[model samples]
Target: MMRTRFAPSPNGPLHLGHAYAALVAHDTARARGGSFALRIEDIDGERSRAELVEEFLLDLQWLGLEWDGAPIFQSHRLPGYAAAGERLKAMDVLYPCNCTRAEIAAAATKFGPDGPVYPGTCRNRHVDPTGAAWRLDTGRAMALTGPLEWVDEIAGRRDATPMIFGDVVLLRKDLPASYHLAATLDDAADGVTLVTRGMDLFPASHIHRLLQALLDLPVPTWLHHPLLVEPDGRKLAKRRGSPSLGDCRRAGEDGRAIATALREGRFPAGISLSQGIHQTP
Candidate 1:
């Protein structure tokens, strides 16, 4: 049986974009007679709020989406991430990186898909494994995996090009794992068959594919749907003042009606779908 998941971070209240993604994931699995799971990606360390997790659950319940089994929290899976990192460390493909964001930005000359690629300043430097962030040596990793590809239900087949993000971080100094490492590992661990997410994450799939190859994990198909955008052509984001689902609910808007509209591709006033795939920063 196919399994899918709707993983959300509890750093803030759920928004319209999140609702759209969750509904799509839930409905898609149901349409396939498959199982749908909800995962709390609270891997953001101190930034993730416990209260927001309850709000997220309530919002999903209001939308009439039900998930199978108990939700998995990333915070509770630290040991698994550590084990995966240890495997990578044993493979000698992982290297400790101590460079800060500003330092890399200042040193990087050319831009790649995921912003200015890391200049590999600390690529050769040795540091305490537990104290420094670990980065995948993209060049060596590509050489190890050779040519690879993953299929998207919408975008079709894509060549794996993780190097576009340069040597991406797998584990952080303060956190047990980076998004790239944890999400990929968890998807495989949960036996997710289809990954439904926004088009903005299309590029990140390349890295995930590579991780699957390196970790010897199961590969899942992808579906990168268009993002919910405003009239100004900007994607809805909390930082940009996008209203939360709670805000809409408090104003007496019917949650079921909103969910139905989203499923039908109808959006609120000034909100539409964006077709562009975005670069991760």
Candidate 2:
């Protein structure tokens, strides 16, 4: 059976953008007689909040989105992430790096899809592994996997060029796993067949494809849908302080109606949809 998921972090309240993504995942799975699962991406110890998980669940329910099975929480899967990191370490494709953001920003000369491309400063250095991040050796990883490709429902077939992001982090100094590692592993563990998310994350699939090949995980098809944006074309985000669904619910607004309107390309004034440009993290 085809499976899709809407994994949301519990660092903030759900906004209309979250609503759109959830509805797309839910409706697509239901339409094909498949399953839609919800995964709470609450692994960020510094930012993730236990209370917000319940709030987001309430918002999802209010929006008439029902996920199959009990929700998966990343916090409970730390050991699995650690094991995956160890597997990569065993492959000799991971190296410890202690570069600070300031150090990287000052030293990096080229920018990749996710930000300043890592200069491989620690690739050859004897940095202390303590309190250091684990970075994937993208060049070596690609050489081992050879040329690869993944298909997106909207973007068509594309080559997997993980090098664009340089040697991306697989494990962070403070977090058990980076977004790329954890999300890929979680999807495979959940038997998810279709990865539905916003177009802004389209570039991430390249790195994910590499990880899947390295870990010998099942590859899933993807749908990078358009994003809900403001009138000025800024993608709605929690950091931008987008209005929360809780606010709408408290005002007695109809959640389903809002979802229907969104499906029909009808958004509130100053809110629009866009195929957002590829972003830098």
Candidate 3:
């Protein structure tokens, strides 16, 4: 059976951007006769709030986006993330570094293209004796020898390659799991075959695809829908306060009106969404 999820971080109120994404995910899974899962990505413990989490759930429900199963919280899955990290660490694919933001900035200025990109300066040597964070080793360019190809339901044929993202951090010393690690692991755990997300996440697909390889997990078929952009061409942020579905509901905006307004104001060209976008098996 096909399964998909809309994983959103509960750092703030659910704005129009959240509404659009939820609608897309719900509509997609329903049209496909698949299971829809709600995945709460409150990975950032410091920033994520329970109040915001409740609001997110209520907002998604208000937007008419119901799910088939109970929600999965990444914050609660620390052991899973840690286990995955251990597996990679044992393979000598990860190393520790003590570089801070300021130090990394300075290094970026001194180093070139991929050089500034973490540089793996701390990979071979102990740059800092203490306060080190873990990093993925990309010193020797990661190569994947396989017929790696997945059909994107929206964008079509995405030929995945390991060299695309090189090495990516699965966990931080401070945080249990990074976004890439938790997300990929959750998909594997939930048996999610279809992944529906915003276009902004497309570039990061390479990283997740690589994680799937390293962990021997099934790579979920991707569908990168267009982001909910504003008139100024900037993507909607929670701070913008464009009014969430719940907010609009309180303000007397019917579901039909909200949908029509979004189609008219935010998305022109009538938004050709995938009712049942099939992927190549």
Candidate 4:
């Protein structure tokens, strides 16, 4: 059975971009006689707002998106993440690093899709596990997994080259798991077969594919759709003060009508679709 999910963090309001992504996941599942699931990525205790979770549920309901069951919260799956981390440790592909942002910025000589790639300062050092993040030794991991590939609905088959991101973090010092670790596990746990998300996150599939290979998890196809952006080509984000679904709902706007307009590619004035990755500014 085909299953899709729209996993969103509850750190901010759900903007138009989020609505489009949700609709893409929901419509795709419904069209194929599949199930659509929602996952609340609220593990970041410092940033995730408890109030926003309810608001997000209300927003999705207002948009007429009925998920298969109650939303799965990442916070409830810490022990699973911890167990996964230990498995990776047994594989000897995980290493602890205490590098601060300032330290990495000063030492990093290369930049990846996300930001300054880690210079592997702690790769050879035995850092204290206390308050240290666990980073995947991508080179070592690739050596173990060999070459890998994943299928995308739009991009077709592509080789998995996770090295571009360098050694990515699987577990954070403050959080039990990073986005890559938690999301990949949660999707597999929910039996999601199609991972629908924005094009901006297309690069992340490389890492996720590698994780699947290491963890012996089931692989899923992906659909990286274009994002709704501002006239300036910047993706609509909550931090950018983009108009949110809540704002629209409170203004007496019809959620279904808005969804229909989005499905028809008829965005509101000043909002457009961006096919490429845009820097959040």
lDDT of 4 by residue, 110-212 (tens): 9988899999999999799888999999999999999999989988888998988899999998888999999999999999999999998888999999999
Root-mean-square deviation per candidate = 1.9, 1.6, 4.8, 2.4
Q: Candidate 2: misplaced stretches above 4 Å?
A: 277-281
Error of 4 at 224 (Å): 0.3
- lDDT for model 3: 0.70
State residue 210's C-alpha deviation in candidate 4, in Å.
0.6
Q: Mind sharing the TM-score for model 4? A: 0.97
Per-residue CA lDDT of model 3 for 1-281, tens digit only, reads 78888888887777777777777777778888998889888878688877777777766666556888788888788898888888987877777777776777676534322334554567788555244566777533244324456657767787665344434556676778888788889999988898888776665676677678767998789887777666665667777775565676667656655654654544434233333321212
The Cα error of candidate 1 at residue 216, in Å, is 0.7
Question: How accurate locally, in lDDT, is each candidate?
Answer: 0.90, 0.92, 0.70, 0.93
Best by lDDT: 4
Ranking by TM-score: 2, 4, 1, 3
User: How much is 246 displaced in model 1, in angstroms?
Assistant: 1.3
Candidate 1 lDDT score at position 221: 99
1-281 in candidate 2: lDDT tens per residue?
Answer: 99999999988888999999999999999999999999999999879999988888888888888998899999999999999999999999999999989999999988987789999999988989989999999999998999999988877888887888999999998888999999999999999999999988889999999999999999999999999999888889899899999999989999889889988989989999896556322
Candidate 1 residue spans exceeding 4 A from truth: 128-130, 278-281
Clashing pairs in 4: none
Better of 1 and 4 by lDDT: 4
Better of 1 and 4 by TM-score: 4
